[model samples]
Target chain A: MFFLRRSLATSATADALAIESDSGSPAKEFKIMSGVILSRPPIITPEQTAFSKAYYHYQSELYKRMSWTFPYWFYYPKGTLAENEYTRVQPKLNEKDPDVLFNRDRNSKQDVVFPPRSVQRETEESARIYAKIVPNPRTTIADEENNIRSLERKLDRTLYLIVKRDGESLEWSFPATTIESGENLESSSTRMLAQYGGEDMNIFLVSGTPALYYKDVYESDGKYEGAKIFYLKSRIFNGLFKPQKESGIVDYAWLTKEELSSYLDKQYWRKVAGALSKQ
Target chain B: MAFFKPSFGTDLRRQSTAFFQCRSLHSSAPQFKSPVSIVHPVHHRVRYKKSILHPKYQTLLTIPKWDPRSHLFKPQAVQPSRVKTHWETTLAPDLMLANYSHNELKLRGRKHQEWDGSSPYHVNRPLRSPAGNAMATPDILPRTFRTVPFVTSIWVNTFNHRAVTEHAERNIPSTVMIQQITGVKPAPAYSGVSIMQWRLRKERNVGAVVEIKGAKKDQFLATLVEVVMPRVKDFQGIANSSGDKFGNISFGLDPEGVRLFPEIEGNPDLWSGITGLNITFVTTAQTDPEARLLLSSLGVPFYGRERFHNVPNLDGTKQTRKKGVVYYENSQE
Candidate 1:
């Protein structure tokens, strides 16, 4: 019993030391220190292989829906502030003159105090592609990646469209839609853009990637239990932003990054940062 | 008449004897026959009053003869009972006359409706009535009064004396403690005011605070109400007067009370010294009473006026009621 206890204690200490050493030292150093030994790889069973395949399959499906990429437009324009066009000239008074001192009371009574004009912060000119995730089951991972690469190559030539909601506040969001049956990711994205930005607008995919993955549990018990959104970056090749009213878009703005930051939430900024960091 | 009434001792003995006799009789015998059988008499019947019809009035039987040639044929315009006043025509006319236009009043109302003190957009304007006069009236019912009050946020503030004493002692432990208790990261609180004697400087890191909301707030409140509060010794419940006028209530807990929390007590090694916590509960109730009611429903016990003292009657007689202790005398005995 004493020998068994000693062996157990040694094994526990070894495990703890192994964990500590694993974190502190590099794997190569640890291997060299421990004296490297070559051994045959363990034989994997058919069941294990199948289980791993199934796990990957589930992960790929989640990846397809969750991964999103949007084009980051970085445009900073340098320009002097427009002179206060509404500034009015005031009558000057000389403090050294005796007459000015005699008329001080009258001047004080005639003083008309106008509220100070609000100072507007100068903003930089930059634009961002408001891309949303639209999952396409038909498109393979390789095909999606290839499409995004193709889109990235055409980024400079494309003119992206902005969609806005028709309301007092003029809320804006990206043109996003789910991939319909038999539609690929590229086609679905183009369709959503065309539907919101009008068919006249010559829009092309600038770049596309599974940039952001957001899990949305719309219904817990339904067949489509949850949805993953994949954001794809796109830009307009040529055409003006003519918002389709039928699709609930009333207005659009070609704003800079600074201006866009004021309009978008913190989450959007975080997403932008993530996309930019990848680049 | 006083002498005729039985003495107290004799009356007690009589009642006791009667009770014992009744008990003894029940134990002495079990009757074969059924006891207290209820009977219905065959002749018993309920007779409702019969209604008698009366002749209709002569005037009701005949309709007035219509004459096309009469002056009644010419329709006369009826005057309106209530005229549209200027006050009715304009939306909140008194407010408009007082330089508060309809737009301004609406803006203020909207601001108040969405007012959560933690938000930077909250405007600190006094609540006013439709007449443009500041509403000094207490307990004004909100337009959207709900049965259940919503907890806006739970703010936890604590000053770390250990940090002050040992400059090397950072707020790491305090931050960890707060995180463990609230399940959210705590923000470091800086001293806004400086005190020369206390060696405190403005913007000096003195403590940490965490504002909990949503599901986490509910969970923290449940732990506070169910586990921590019950374990505290000599707890007389929270006072009703501990609230800001705008339905926010802040209460301080001593080091002992803080120690009573399961998170702190369960893992003593995790926390070396107990720090007093000031927990402020921001609620959506307009008045203190409403907030108190809301908190009480959420399992926070409140101390009533009678909780502390047993006052004498106006006649200078000693009241039988005792403070802090409940007595239940068995009347059967």
Candidate 2:
């Protein structure tokens, strides 16, 4: 049964695990670390291109035309004052006219205009339903100020959490910590995340399995020949990162994929790029 | 009056016989049983048209399904879908992340075991019915991009007892109501069993069922979530224990709840004498929890205690939230 158990995963990390000893010596004992790629997915739909906007508008118009006709008789019964008022505003189509052929062709392109009801006549529910609503601006204060640390910025792209360690001079990396003896990747990553990033958060680890692993070797050292770091995916649904002063994290940033590339080392970016979502 | 009387009865008898081309019915008349005419199966293409086989269609050897040249082509309505757009932009990634399992193994459901072949009798014996369970549940396929849970279709049906007790045509209003809502005509359902107490017989028309797919399915879901559900008085969220062993979930709405639907609400008079609606959501998810997750993300709330399956979170724990559980939060920060 143990031999029959075949892993369903064909992940790049799984393949990387096989090639670990290919670089380092067979007897080399490597240090294991756990890292989390805490990310905030897009809040809004990506900004539409001009072509997409025009196309959607065209499609919407066509869709409206194909939709069911507004039943004037249902709402405004025949010979009622409301029905008379509704019909009076619209152009009367003559079936005998050359332009008008089918019943659908008559006023199908235009929406039925209805007479406005007096505020006094309207019920509170009807008034609430009919009230106009305006949407807030897409760009927030964080975006306006170009605040990389704030989660509010980049409303339409996947923003990742990268931290600057106290000792590291220029290296900005995903929150990671060395694995203690006998500790697994997921538990270590969760501990590292809450310690480095603040515990005041509702972030979820995507999976217990590590998404990617990075290995480095020190040829001069015999006892511990290399270091192995495994990255786990996590998502911050709600909450802000307050860097723990005791955790030795100097600074933190919430960045999109393109921005992360500039802050992360080129070699590290190559390994981590595939793990993050494009959007 | 006897025809032998040679009076007005004789004239009526002759006329009746001439028209009927059979002996007149009387107390002494031998009963006549008409022979049934049997027609053999005919060899012909149903609704066939010779013009379709013309040379004009020669260029359509590999025409796409949406192409006019294809025989099965239906013009796809280009509507700006709200749910689909939301799914692509937001829900899809979130679900993928939420559903991610650590090296997930495809779970095999109950299946019939092979014969042990220990004896001659066992060699050819029919496979034993699936070891523990009588029914075979579907395999729980590992989550992948293509296999992510989505609403395939929505089945909305309502049975009217009046159709069976009264005339079969009494179900027309329900049929029309469903058609108005779905834009697709529903097929009539029939009674499967005879019930003497209810005056129900086999083959009796019971009600109608409408299955809306693609864009219409999403529209109906959107309407239910946004408009109808909120208007239903004293409405509790869908109960936790509602799904079939498979991924499909069903819930019933009272007649009042049905009346709240915009199609019927617009003209209550037209949709009169209707019963409650039983709505089922068919999803691609392999299990109930996954299907619930998909629906909950789409703004369908669920209530009651639920045992979550493998919802591993940070802090090295598997958590479940009972009461009204919301899978998605569209909080703008």
Candidate 3:
């Protein structure tokens, strides 16, 4: 009887172990519970509690003064209404060629026609791309080994294509450009190189998500206007490059990481370095 | 006199016999000299004899102290003179060799003594080598390992009221609200460009703003996550897709939602009108997923999909309709 009981206990323990290993459901539940249990308890001051009571009273009074209306179509799936509207009016809008609408702003009497603010204004709908072009890999075994050795030694040596901005003063920067509407990141980067880089260059997209930059255009009256820049990376398979003067690139040079530091600010260089190292 | 002399002889004989017995006992018993010998009393040593196999085995297996063959396993003794000039005799001569074969063999192995593309371990060989052409191989991007999420700063802004009328009401309440919420005095924001529609003029003070950082930022976030957000009615989690693709996520709160804060809710008389606020969480994470994970770990809820319900359409057809309720995954479940 003792042996029988011992066997039963061992089997039960084994079954428990099997259940623990076989199914992830229990573990997931435990994780969620742990997350909540591990969080620090909130501390509320007496004054805060009093304030909340007063706020609730104020909100009640405000509610009495105003009647609320529920938003229409809150439960409808996305694109249903837009699809219906598009089917109804698309033919008429298309006949006129919608591209003309953009040009009409140029002829409008108003000097500046600000685009209508989007309902969601936190992030831009359109994504930007930034590219870092690296030199081709060495072909010979010895050269490759040397490259590896240098990298192991933390002796980073790479050439960066820096362009001179044609502004109030000549400011040096990497070959970066904003992605145009209807064009993808890779194509935009290639076009930017062709236009500003000055020379025929072959390049391919390097793996990794683009680095993001938030440039605050203006900050006034508690309103902030900003642009998001997505930085990407690419390797120049073949290219003979020169800086173009017509594109505001008066001068250009292949500079090492250390040399690039002297030309670019710390923040700007950090972004460039991030894209390069991502390769 | 004869009797006394006879007794003295007998006494002498007895004394000699006792002395001879003492000598015999002393010679028979083992004498110990070393301090450790105290542990092995003479009687104990006699009872347990030393095993003959122990010393025989030890002698057969033990390597000699000065054997050069054992130098690989044991540490080599360094002479002060040799240590001072060994680099000149060894390292310099190895370095001076034109081919570097000796150094290569020592550093790598015999297999890598000669430069061959097919060497099992080449310095430049890609880790987990790809099955195709080497030149066509993709480069490995560096991974930046970030451990903790930190709030860099919090920015609060309000709009300009000058465009409504010449006697347009100034946004004093908003400025006071920001000050009350942040516990810091707000600075006036100026317009950089002139916009005719909004009647915004360049260099005109349009709104008030306050930037909170360090410990104050932590306090504000605690209030936001623990006190304010949970109290919001019909509150769904922040959209999972929200973020600047980078680590920063920016979300806006309506005037109604902003009113839930204790700072705003506590003072009924101080509130004049509704003022909206934009809160941006800046994290050290490089990607949106990482940032969202970090935020969720901090107790900020995120909604997966918007909740939907069945409703009758205008044409008397039953249709599936969405409700304002966002389906939030109860992470604590």
Candidate 4:
């Protein structure tokens, strides 16, 4: 496996070495070399291939619908704040003048204090109301979560601060699962497991030009619900490459054997038929 | 006595050969059954069906009867016979030969559909949003009782005639005559609009307050009433008119008003050119919590310049504050 260092400097620092010859003679004995040959390339299983394709397809579909922004602001009409209504404004460290606050007591002289004509921070009630119109991320995150996932539990969006090679600021969002999964996202193998279900189950992953599938029968509820197989499928052109997208299938339960029996059995049920026919 | 000893020697020679033959037969039995035991489910089904259909034929055709002297055919039990056949086939020189390939090919196709829907999406169908016509509301519902101090201007660029020409031939809307004259689409016609510019403030204010010192307060108020207010209403509950494409919109303080207000322009610390405007409403119904949450979740940037409470310098320290969103989660009182 190739280790991908976040920076070129770190990559340069790492080295692998091997000693090829053990001869003791002076001229013949001396060559120390660096570099390791991988005995085998990491095998890309059919399931892994299917999973990555499905994920990319889902991402592309989401990117198309990303253009629209939500509308849900509270209405505050015109002429709410009076024209001359003002209050004691707070000043920066250097801008602070103790005389400005004390000089404007109601009993002393004027109810409203007016300092020099120089502008200070205008903490107007209208500005506050206007500022409120800004969208809060916490609420958006919550709303976005509910719109997607089927489970009641929320998917945590953890951000990783990263700087691009060009020195641009960047952040990455790691998809969330149950907290029990683990805290260190870097070590979480669940990401791979989540994409492609377990092995030892009857499954065939097809990867080429889209139509990807992740089919595995696990035990969910009492009556072999988990064994009920599911496949995540999307066309390459329609989902991954299409400029427009309509919707996504986040979570879907597998059909029971009885339910599957009603439909004319086609190609997908090869393994299913083999297992059931044995019985 | 010598003749009796000669008979014993003859019997011993014959017994030795028989014993060696029996050992050879015992060793072969286990080797034969090993292959049948490891058959995949597909192979098992094929054997099961074949055995049930033609049992009598196998019994009469192969192998000798149990009686050693008779030398007649004896029927073997299906299980034992299958076990023997499995081993024979497995150990054969041509073991890798394809026997059930035709059957396997047919099964593979069946597996594809069950795993994922192989059918293509019906592209010709009309696009329908899952949420349908439901509109979003702010997370923290704006307080009607709380007096607003400034006017909140939301710019809605419903349809751009210039952009439409590329997709399909169309003329600019009659309202965009100003956009053509100035070569600048008025703030109302800009594609992206955010209400968070007003929502992030600690104090309540009005857009009208900022307009007071501007060049034309009368014209500004007219724009607020005639153009801005209608767009806000359109967002709140836009009637299903034939022309409404439901395009992008933004909410912020009027740039004109922000520039004119001396307090905003003079304070470099408080406002970094980002302005605010308050929205005032006349409402009778109790504000719904869901509506508030919806509005709070509007296209406010959780990151970037438009996040709530991320004043360019709110704490009065000169530190450059990064922008982030405040998720308003009101208690379920």
Number of the predicted model whose TM-score against the real structure is largest: 2
Candidate 1, residues B99-205, lDDT tens digits: the string is 11111111122111333477565567544333323333233332221322457789998888667667725677777678778877799988889878777777778
RMSD of 3: 41.9
lDDT of 2 by residue, A99-190 (tens): 44332354456456667666777888988877878777889999999999899998878899998887625589888787765556666777
Off by over 4 Å in 4: A1-279, B1-276, B280-293, B296-298, B302-333
TM for every model, in the order presented, reads 0.29, 0.71, 0.28, 0.15
> Where does candidate 2 chain B have its weakest 10-residue lDDT segment?
B324-333
Candidate 3: clashing pairs of residues:
A75-B321, A75-B322, A75-B323, A76-B322, A130-A230, A130-A232, A221-B206, A221-B207, A222-B158
Model 4, C-alpha of B32: deviation from truth (Å): 99
lDDT of 2 at A131: 80
TM-score, chain B, model 3, is 0.45
Deviating ranges (above 4 Å) for candidate 2:
A1-28, A63-70, A92-110, A180-187, A216-226, B1-65, B68-77, B89-143, B162-170, B180-184, B226-236, B259-274, B303-333
lDDT of 2 by residue, B1-104 (tens): 21122233445456445545655575433222111112343322223354655788766756877664576554344555678877775677667656765556
* Displacement of the residue B200 alpha carbon in candidate 2, Å: 3.1
Model 2 / residue B9 / CA error / Å: 46
What is the per-residue lDDT of model 3 for residues B198-266, given as tens digits with 9 covering 90 to 100? 766777766677887655666677788888889888888788668754467777777888898887774
The 10-residue segment with the lowest total lDDT in model 2 chain A: A1-10
Question: How accurately is candidate 2 docked according to DockQ?
Answer: 0.22
Residue pairs whose backbone atoms clash in candidate 2: none
Clashes of each: 17, 0, 9, 70
Model 1, A1-279: lDDT tens per residue? 001011111121111222233466532211100100001111111122576666656545443323221111111112312222211322345455423332232222223222233345323321121233564444345344543222222221211223466643455444455555555444566776666657775643422223234433433332343344455444344555565767677665443334445655566455543432110
- Categorize the docking of model 4: incorrect
Instruction: Tell me the tens digit of each residue's lDDT in model 4 across A124-186.
Output: 754553453663333345345543222111212211111111112122111121112222212
